[model samples]
Target: MSDFPSIPRLTSSKYFSSLLLLRNIWKGGDLSDDMQFQRVVNQRTYKGELILFAFDLCSVSDALNAVLMLRHVGFEHFLPLTDGAATCEALHALADVKALPTTPCFWSSSSNNHKGWDTWGAGAGCVSGERRRGYCKAEQLWAIRYHVAARLLASRVNLLHMDTDTVIFNDIYTRLKRKPISDYSLILLPESPVNGGLWYAQHTSLDSGAQWVIAEVARRTWEVISLRIRRRSSPPFDQAMLADALVSAMKGERHVAYMCEHPAVALQPPCANASQSRCAYRHYEWVVATLDARNATPLYRACFWRGDAIVTTDEHVIARKQRLVAVH
Candidate 1:
């Protein structure tokens, strides 16, 4: 028996159904419209690989800037996931004014009726304005993010999921493409000790072990959300949930590997050298690769001054992000 509380599968749960209802609301449940949306997603793919990210009205500016930076580095294909028609509309308008050639996939409730996200915290009357506005929290946003990623993976779409605050100096797609796909199911960047901000998920069939790994992570995500709703105390962040899920999988006898990819060296056992400054590990079909801190530093680190890809900014504040973009 599992110690974790029982939660329904994401695709079959009421929460998932509610999210779908919101997404279909804009099109009046038109099949053709859904087909067109799928076409748009496919059209944005570059050699079957695409970039995915989630944002809200609160973080739309950061999202737009992230898109611009991605394009500036020659990344064309992207799928920006967001909630609310206002946020989606604002994102498109910003993209148009900036000449960004990508479409955002809006899949959550609108400004007026946010019943869809009630279980995810919107029902608590959280108004979206800035990152720190109202009762809106990062965990709520992450709940939505993991759901979208799980849905995409279930549909066999390979993607590199990134946070909006990230700044890339090199062509990340080229670097990711070089990694052998058969070697791992997920490629993740380390944030402190847990994986967050940036990661890659490969397309996998419904019955594949890799898909099982994806489902496991999604399951943990829902569990985290459920706990947050039931308890008054703060719950673990999504990053912590991810870390726990991967660790559970490893303990369950799944194949996991760890390597330090920054120096372009061969895979070494966990902590092979006591003197090694940076190290990463992988799980079952999931691979955790660490980038040189100087190249992909997380927000908590002070190495962004000479970083190649700022994994993320400290907060969702737009002004600070804009300054970072200007400097880099």
Candidate 2:
């Protein structure tokens, strides 16, 4: 196991206040129809509680704005995870969510000038399947290793890990239920069976069963990335690592559950007006423009086509662009 340190607890009121201000600035001066938005948000935010973990790069305004929009629609309790004092304060100001300290990340700006780039070590040779691009291999190894360690150290906390690009349209907790008291140990993307897009786990105590599963996955990802280190330079295929680990865990003694749901339909691009249940799943489908042929970003126009079109967006291009630009 890697010896990366776990995230330290925060003790600064100043830092907390700053994150709060940054959050407020991100919100701008928009009026919220709490009732209307709440109706939409209520589906996910039940009293049992759900935690949203978004990893923010330099600025988290985009993800936090997603939280605010979810709140205006009526879902609250979105948390922003950060690695700096300034970032923490900025996020807190904009929303009534928790601001947790950042854990060890894949690569900070400082590593750009480091010597490990060209050197090969056991760390560099971990990739076993498809090769990975340069630098990214080391990054995946470090990220998964550190994140697992951090989760181990955080007592009594259940973590839900998410990338920054996603937005929440419903109360995520309500959809996930396993006997109510014992929630799912792992929840993953439905489209991808082998890999997980989101992860849910209790961090207070290490489950030997769970640890075995996490470690195996991390190891597989490292192998896939490292095997290619001698060939290609860099690859953004961390998801593949996740897939390998998850598949291994299922095959092993510790059978962690993977849940897949049709991501909420109302969250889809506006023009893809297809009903939620009717949507189909399409892999790696990219459209430069919407089905209507109007302009849209890859994600807004691009969709995972399920039978009839399960996942669609209603957000216009201008508004989505504004949201993207408004992030700090």
Of the candidates shown, which would achieve the greatest TM-score relative to the real structure? 1
Provide the lDDT at 19 for model 1. 26
**Consecutive 10-residue window with the lowest summed lDDT within model 2:** 319-328
lDDT per residue (tens digit) for residues 147-256 in model 1: 65665565677767778876654334333444343344555542345555676666454534444554655565444334323324333456545544454343332222
Q: Among these predicted structures, which one has the highest lDDT?
A: 1
- Model 1 misplaced stretches (Cα beyond 4 Å): 1-37, 96-105, 109-120, 124-135, 179-182, 207-210, 224-235, 253-328
* RMSD per model, one decimal: 15.9, 18.1
The sequence of per-residue lDDT tens digits that candidate 2 reaches over residues 1-328 is 1121322222221111123222322221101233422331232223423344433333356655544443343333344433323334455544444443222111122212223333322233233122233222434334433344333323233444454554444333333332331333433344433334354444223433334344445443333333323333442344543433333232332211111121221222321442222111123221111111111111232233344233223332211111110000
For all candidates in order, the CA lDDT equals: 0.45, 0.32
